[model samples]
Every structure is written in C-alpha cells, then in structure tokens.
Target: MTSFQFTKMHGLGNNYIYVNQMKEQLPEEELSEIAIRVSSVYTGIGSDGMILICPHCCTCEDAHFQQ
Candidate 1:
C-alpha cells in the first residue's frame, strides 16, 4: 500500500482535506480511495471531502492538470 501526506483546513466554515500531489507521487487508481479514506469522520483525517492541490500545467494530459 502506498501512503501519501495531507492537511486538513477550513475556508469560511467549509472543511476539506488537502493533498499536494505536486510533491508526493501517487497512483492514479488510488485517488478515489485516498479521498474516501481521508474524509472519513470516524477513522480518518476527518474532513468534509478532499481538495487535491496540484501544480499548474499546460498539458491537459498531465495528472495534475486534469481537464
């Protein structure tokens, strides 16, 4: 199992788990599971959802620059 790092934050009351995919490499298939795992209120990061913060890229094919 591959593990990544994340941070929890709120904006004007709404909370979300932030994942910086720019620095941490993760498999594409695992993104959905990561979001679910991180947003769990019982045994996880405990957030409303996940907000993946990735780098900006000109290529739409880039994982971080999903269209």
Candidate 2:
C-alpha cells in the first residue's frame, strides 16, 4: 500500500485537489488510476478532481515539461 498527500481548496462550494509536481513525483502512466482513487469519497480524499501543478524550467510558452 502507498500513501499520497494533497492540498485541498474550495471556491463557491466547488472542491479542488492540488498535487504539487515540483516536490512530488508521480508516475505519468498511472495518473488516471490515481485520480480515480483520490476522487473516491468512501476510500479516498473525496475531492471533485485533481490538479497537477508542475514547475516551469523553460521559457517556451508551448513547451511541455516532464520529469
């Protein structure tokens, strides 16, 4: 079993889950499963959805950042 941590936020009654990619590393192939697991109200954190925030290392506006 593995444990994950997230920051929670809400606006106008809508919930949000913030996952800091800069400090936390999650396997890209399993993001969908992780998202579903975290969104579960019974077995998980119970949020509307997950937002993966990444760090910007390049100046290209259209550049994709990955680790």
Clash statistics: count for each candidate: 0, 0
- Candidate 1 clashing pairs, residues 3+ apart or interchain: none
lDDT of 1 by residue, 4-62 (tens): 77788898878887778797767879877777776787758688787787677675665
Question: Which tens-of-lDDT digit does each residue in 7-55 have in candidate 2?
Answer: 9898998887888889777887887788888778987878888888878
The stretch of ten residues in a row with the least summed lDDT in candidate 2 is 58-67
* Model 2 TM: 0.75
List where candidate 2 sits over 4 angstroms from the true fold: 62-67
Q: What is the lDDT of candidate 1?
A: 0.73
Report how far off residue 16 is in candidate 2 (Å): 0.9
- lDDT, each prediction: 0.73, 0.78
Q: Model 2, residue 12: what's the lDDT?
A: 92
Superposed Cα RMSD, model 2: 4.0
